[model samples]
Target: MSDLYEKLKRFQQNTPVQKPSPPALVPSSSTSKPLPDQLLKIPGIVRGSQVMEKIQQRDDAKKKFLSTLGVNEVTNPAGKYGYREIKISNRELPITKEDIGGLEIQTISRDASLAVFNANDFLFFDTETTGLAGGTGTTPFLIGIGFFDEDGFRVCQYMMRDYDEEAAVLHDLVKQIGRFPALASYNGKCFDAPILQARFLLNRLRFPITDMPHLDLLFAARRFWKKMLPSCSLSTVESRILGRTREEDISGELIPYVYFDFLRGIRIERMRPVLFHNVEDVVSLAMLAAKICRMVRHPENECRHGWEWFGLGCCLAAAGMWERTFFCLEQAVLEPSLSLEEWIAINKFLSLSYKRLARMKEAVDVWQRMIERGEDVFAMIELAKFHEHTEKKYAEALALTERAILQMRNRQNDVMANGPATVMYEELLHRWNRLLEKRKNP
Candidate 1:
């Protein structure tokens, strides 16, 4: 209800803000903003021939690793066990409900589902692909999977020696999941799953990815951390919620180039650092997932805002957890959107959720007010249909249809060319006229 900008200004004025460090600058006479200092700090950022030398150094490391893990002159136990002394023994960690399940914090212990979250079968995972464009052509150079076993949480990585060894890496991941139940990740839904799936199919590996119940911490980060921080990205979530920070290190963007260096026989030296970066990504996934779970179970401890609840609802909806979705939706609707478009989008989702639960009256009320606040064509059509069918108000329905046409005409008058909206407007006008005639006769 309060002005958002005013509220932000008040909060800033009240809170003792941290004083920023003095920024590094170039010697420029004019009073223009200096170029970023961080840009100058990039290591191994050399492209072309210098970058190729880095790859040769990495390849040399790979060969040394192979020599050290010496071939057995025997077939590996049904799968390629390139360099690791990985054994197929029954070596699960002691993950009882009492030890790992309950957090010391009372709020968190009470909220986590007693039946589902047993702590034994949940694993946190992350990956670094050759490139972000995941196809059969793209390969996962490294995958980091972590869990709390007997010796606290351990990050286990499966790394491909080169592009040629991608199959072995994917096979190990699919095999590892057979030993676990649920998996957790941050934005793994968008990037990790598809990459793994493509790799698996190419290798003739059968992985039951769809069957696995995944908790994408990206969704949870949005829910539990959005109020605490504006960005729900993993690193931000880790910093803001968990009170942790990663030291300046190699980024994921450099990884493909790191591999390309290895491939080109140049970066024989930097593979160690590249592997170090991959290992850190896996470790961060574990830490970030744990941080999110802690916040979700104890919303009070975190001072979460309304957008957190909105995010929570979205997470629950994606997971198909209806009861939890209802709880989150109730919270989100309390804090209506700050802008008309934001309100309409939120209200639209809320109305659809209500509709899913057979709460037609609630859905109708939501759509009606939603249309009044922002009379887009979609809202008008939905409201008009509801008025005609549900309320037996043909006059009201016809009026809404006319309003929709006026909105369309205004939008077209503002159009630059024959875009998608123009075609939709032409179609919508004909549809509205047909609907109005039907209502008039009936």
Candidate 2:
């Protein structure tokens, strides 16, 4: 048994064990045969080479298109995904500092902080977005800003080449916006400003314009031209107010699609019109803001039409500028171009302005004129209150109240049908009874 064990150990010690070989290294390039045309045509099967080729083609097309628009690539340390900028010289645009100068921001915006800024301190801003359904999802692909410089009105457009570059665009845009003390935009308060604020919030950056004095020209445009123009959109105001029409422009509805197409690397030339449209919008914003401010400053000479006077009056009235409201309304009533409805509205506002200014005689005159025209129950009630409270003329108050009550009775069926009209009738009746008692006692 010992001899057998020694022989087995000697056999084990003398045997040579074989080591497993390492797996063979494959070449960097595959040598496998290409897939057949039929297999490659399957929905999910695409060659890596073909995918890369398409990406290269798209990148080439985008680069070529951006070059034609005179756009420059922007890089910063905060973000690697750089944005693009297109600078438009003052000579390329028709506007100048003289055109937009001499604006009273307080009168136009009614914000005293805005009063500190001159035309040069304002940034005329506009944005072209991915979609009108605004949210964080609605990205501003292009932002156009115009400002006055020693050279004149120069425009700078900041655009994101792709969705990933939005952070870079916002980073640069906040820097530019920080230079301006005031911001003016057409319909920006409702649309552009909110979307930009959301983008800044999502990018974890502070919105520079949040505390800036913002003058949304949309409200002022509506106040000045809503009655005179068919639509107070920037384009409409541009043609009607600025006396400039875009010879070549893209419709706002098609802008998003054009941007999407550009991003998809098709119809790159369509982006040119979008840039043009944005430039025009920025230019018109400055022009319209200037026009509004000038008209507000000198309504007597600037207002050419009756509706203009009425609009100015309404604006002044809203700001509680009773003296200016009276002057504008007085001029509006003198003009023959006002429609019947407009005339009645102006008269009502004129009377209110007169009352606000403590010009009771002018208020009485306006009420009498409205009454003489068609027995305006509103004017009658207003005059009755004035006579009762201010003058203590109980007989005159009773007469005016009675006339209003009679008018309501004459249209009793219509009055009773409307809830507000019924309430107004009850109020007139109450005034009539109170006035009668006062008249009898006096």
Strongest candidate by TM-score: 2
By lDDT, the best candidate is: 2
Candidate 2 residue-wise lDDT, 30-136, digit = tens: 77656686577776666765888898889778877777777777787555332344455677755555544333556656676776667888898999999988888
Q: How close to the true structure is residue 400 of candidate 1, measured as C-alpha lDDT? A: 82
Using alpha carbons, what is the TM-score of model 1?
Answer: 0.54
| Global Cα lDDT for candidate 1 | 0.63
Tell me the TM-score of each prediction against the true structure: 0.54, 0.84
Q: After superposition, how far is residue 13 of candidate 2 from its true place, in Å?
A: 28
How does model 2 fare in lDDT?
0.82
Candidate 2 regions off by >4 Å?
1-46, 78-103, 318-321, 389-393
The Cα error of candidate 2 at residue 395, in Å, is 3.7
Instruction: Please give, for residues 3-70, the per-residue lDDT of candidate 1 as tens digits.
Output: 99889989889999689999987666866544554443455443444667776776666677544543
The count of residue-pair clashes in candidate 1 stands at 20
Backbone clash count, each prediction separately: 20, 0
